[model samples]
Target: MISIRSVGKTYRSRHGEVVDALDDVSLDVREKEFVSIVGPSGCGKSTLLKIIAGLVPASGGEVTIRGRPVREPFPDVGFVFQNAVLLPWRTVLDNVMFSIEMLGLPGNDYRARARDLIELAGLAGFERKYPWELSGGMQQRVALCRALVHDPSVLLMDEPFGALDAMTREEMGLELLRIWEERPKTIFFVTHSIPEAILLADRVVVMTPRPGRLARVLDIALDRPRAVEMEFDPRFKAYSEEIRALIFRPRRERVH
Candidate 1:
């Protein structure tokens, strides 16, 4: 389980001005549950995910995973960023094994795991291909496999499919759902697409604009083993409209 309480982040800009990126955001995620955060650009969706991953520090409050406070990178979680960020020098198989090598784990023990993950990601034959040799979607699949090679209990994905084309993005989403169903990790996915979020997450977290705060957390009622066809469902459309309204709602006036 993951617990976030009153989390906030304030940073000083280059010009020496303070910027409030996130504020008063709190949430609880059950084991193996999938949650997605959505907000306007610059609302600190990425920041919040980083905080949960212990990649970034929170300015206030605390985030705890399974009763442990998060301060720095932990071993039980994996992060997939917007970019695949694969090394030009590494092949798909080698890239997937990179995590194991970096962690100083025995290569012999994890090579099988790496190959299994590569196969799971449908990159079996491309294991020897370099990042440039693969298309964008395949690269992201390699990145995802790399993140999961160590078998993390929690997965933090910051719009991993954001850079793909629409069709590729949906394909990747379906791939992610397949991976999650098979592995069942606690996942925190951050995305701009409401339909994608709804399709992938058990709960959708909506945020206010700047000085981001939790606007709402909607429990998606759509059935599990989700499909693109569900997007046409009335319930799916209703959830989309509700989240859209929350996101596009007028900002409350601030009285100085």
Candidate 2:
């Protein structure tokens, strides 16, 4: 489980102006729970994830995972960025094993796990292929495998599918759900797409613009193994409309 208490982040510009990225943000993600954060650009969604992952220090407040405060890069957390960020020179298998190498973990110990993850992502035969040979979606799948190779307890994903084509993005979403079902990890996914957030999360955490604050957290009551066709459900529409309204409404009128 994770807890973020009164967390805030500020940045100093080259001109010495102070910009607040996150303000008084507090949230909790239960064990093995999937939470999606959606907000406007510069709203600190990614910043919050970085804080949780301990990739960056919070300017104020604290983030703790399983009761321990996070102060530095968490060894038990995995990260997937907007880009695949694969080493082009490495083969698919090597890329997945890259994390193991960085962690100074024994390569032989994780080889089977890496191969299984590659297959789970539906890239079985392509393990020997290079990044340049794979499609955008396939490349991201490799990145996902790499993130999971170490079997981290929590996965911090920042728009892992944002760059793919629409069709591919949808496909990857389904793929991600399937993988999560088989190998569930506490996942905090940050995305800009409303529908994508709803489709993938058990709860959607809405955030405000710069000086980002938690606006609302809506529980998704949709059934499991949700398909794209389910987007037509009236409940889905209602959730989408509510979230859109929250994002577009003036801050003063917003209800948290």
Candidate 3:
């Protein structure tokens, strides 16, 4: 579980002015729950993810994973970026084994696990292929396998499928659901697509622009073990629309 309380981040510009990225963002993510954060660009969605992952520090407030304060990147959490970030020289298997190596495990120990993950990700026949040799979707699959190879308890994904084409994005979404079924983990996904968030997450968190704050938390009560067919369901569309309204609702002026 991850808990963020009164978290705020501010940076000083070259001119000595402060820029606020996040403000008083508070939320709790339960174990085995898949949550996605959506907002306008520069809403600090990525910053919030990084803060939880310990990749960045909050200027104020607290972030904790499983009740312990998050000061540094924990081994139990895996991060996937928009780019695969795979090494050009590393083959698929070697890439997936990178985390195992980082954990100081013997090569022979994690070789089978890496192989199984690669195969499970639908890259069994491409284990020997380098990142450059595969399509964009295949490369993202490699990144996903690499993130999950170590069996992390939490997965932090920042638009992992945003770079793919429309068709490939849909395919990857279905594939991700299948993967989630096989191995349930606490997942925090950051994306701009309402449908994508509605389709994948148990809860969707909407945020405002800069100095990002939580606008709303929406529970997707569609169904469990969501399949691709769920996307066409009316409930899914209703959820999407509900979030859309929350995101763009008209504001009223305050009277003095």
Candidate 4:
């Protein structure tokens, strides 16, 4: 349902040096498929996600959802960032409804949906609470609800759980899977956690270091309705090892 064709990104450093963040990256994502991207720090995994969201422009190539080429902030796409980024003054319910207000969508139509998402995230009673009153996991849950309040067809998550504690992160991952199962949306997730990526994705995209290129797109063989305990399976370990090998090995030039 999504296609990233020969996408590349270059940035001019403040010191006037051109740095290539991504190079000739191409990938096709299926409908309702969860794809995770893993690579070293500064490998452009997050950059690629932003490019797909139309939040950042790609210096080369293109990203298209369904058949529409993304040129501006997409109306049907939802983005969750590394941080929850909730409004300090807005209550949980208000924060969840913030996207609707910003998008100029009718609040009457989405307020119920917002409340449903808040409830789904296990924060039903805290609708009147502020971000400062919640735990890190709770705050992130609020962000997730806000992102989905509009019923977006695609969700681009850039380390949405990265800031939470390990245990909370695991919980959030399982929660995300449940949400996806109930309401499937094509997701592009970027994370540094190899195990998290494996646990959450159908395919993991491994990239080379700086000037990131697709090193390998490993198809996860683990069964669905996955659980935290499944991370211990031998196949899961094998997939982790394979991705680790690709990331740490010498950077090979990938020409797509």
Candidate 5:
């Protein structure tokens, strides 16, 4: 569903130095594939994602969705940033329904569907509450609902659950799997958590440090409809270690 070919990104710092974030990064995400990206802190994983979302342009190479260059954010794309970014004053239902409203669709048209999403995301009773009124997990669930409310073809998630407590993070992870089962979309998730990536992805793309580049793509042979219980399995541990080793290994210094 997405193709990133030889994509590179550079930023001009205030010091007038050109800094490379990503260098010749190439990857392909097939239709309905759930791929996670893992790397060192400054490895440009987020930069790569923004490029695919068309929020940031690459200095060289290209990112295309279905053969079309990603010149701008596609309507079929849904982005979930690190935070929920919900309007504090809006109710949960209204927050989920906001995108539809922006498209100028009548509220009546999406009311039923929005309600279903709220329920699906386990936020049915909290619909009338404000963002601050809900717990962190609940708010993130609402954020997930908001992103999928429009039924976008691709979901771009950038560490959506990185801020929550461990228990809440685990619960949210399971909830995400449930939602993915009911309504599957091509998901490109950027995360620092090794276990999270293994549990959620069909394939994990390991990246090197800046100037970031693809290091390896490992397929999760683990069976799907994967439950949190699978995390305790020995095979899951193996997968986690493999990815961890790949991500932390030193990279050859980039020659200017």
Candidate 6:
């Protein structure tokens, strides 16, 4: 489980202007729960994830995983960025194994595990290939395998599929769901796509614009093994409309 409390982040420009990125954002993620954060560009969705991952420090408040404060990158956490970020020179298998190498875990022990993860991500024979040799979707799948190769308890993904085409993005969404179902982990995914968030998460955390704050958290009561057809369901439409309103409604209307 994870808990984030009253967390805020601020950045100072060289010109001495202070820009607040996040403001008093708080949320809790239960074990093996899939939570997605959706917000406008620069709404601090990614910043919140970095704070939890300890890639960057929060200017105020705190973030903890299973009660321990996260002051630095924890071994139990895995990260996937918007890009694959693979070492172009390394083969796919080598890239996945990179986690073990970086973490100083037993490489011999995890080599088999790495191979299994590649297969799970549907990149079985592609392990011998390089990032440049694969399609964008395939490259992202490689990134996903690398994140899970070490078997981290928590996966932090930041717009992992944002670069792909619509069709590939949808396919990756389904691919991610399948992998999650087969091997559940506490996943916190950040994205700009509302539909992608709704399709993938058990709960969608909506955030306000600049100096982002939690606007609403909607529980997705959709059934398991969600198919693309479910998007046509009346309940899905209602959830989408409600979220759209929360994000796009006039500021005066949102004031409570």
Please name the candidate that would achieve the greatest lDDT relative to the true structure: 2
lDDT, model 5, position 25: 88
- Give me the runs in candidate 4 sitting further than 4 Å from their true place: 252-256
How high a TM-score does candidate 1 get? 0.97
Candidate 4 or 3, higher lDDT: 4
Question: Lowest-scoring 10 consecutive residues by lDDT in candidate 3?
Answer: 247-256
The per-prediction CA RMSD against the true structure, in angstroms, equals 1.8, 1.0, 2.0, 1.6, 2.0, 0.9
Model with the higher TM-score, candidate 1 or 3: 1
Clash number for each model: 0, 0, 0, 0, 0, 0
TM-score of each: 0.97, 0.98, 0.95, 0.97, 0.95, 0.98
Q: Which model, 1 or 3, shows the larger lDDT?
A: 1
Please write out the lDDT profile of model 4 over residues 1-256, one tens digit for every residue.
Answer: 9999999999988999998999999999999999999999999998898899998999999999998999998879999999999999999999999999999999999888888899999998999999999999999999999989898999999999999899999999999999999999998899889999999999999998888999889999888899999988999999989988887776544443
Off by over 4 Å in 2: none
Task: List the global CA lDDT of all models.
Answer: 0.93, 0.94, 0.89, 0.93, 0.88, 0.93
Cα lDDT tens digits for candidate 2, 109-198: 999999999999999999999999999999999999999999998999999999999899999999989988988899999999999999
Which lDDT tens digits does candidate 6 get at residues 207-231? 9888999999999999999888889
Q: List, residue by residue over 1-256, the lDDT tens digit for candidate 3.
A: 7899999999888999988999999999999999999988888999999999999999999999999999999999999998888999999889898888887778897788889888888898899999999999999999999899888999999999999998898789878878888999999999888988988899999987678898889999988767778989999988888778766765342111
By summed lDDT, which 10 consecutive residues of candidate 6 come out lowest? 247-256
Model 5: per-residue lDDT, tens digit, 47-126?
A: 98899999999999999999999989887898999988889989999999998887677889888889999998878788
* Model 2, C-alpha of 91: deviation from truth (Å): 0.3
After superposing candidate 1, which stretches have Cα over 4 Å from the reference? Answer: 253-256
* lDDT tens digits, residue span 117-181, model 1: 88988888898899999999999999999999999999999999999999999989999999999
Model 3: residues with Cα > 4 Å off, grouped in runs:
250-256
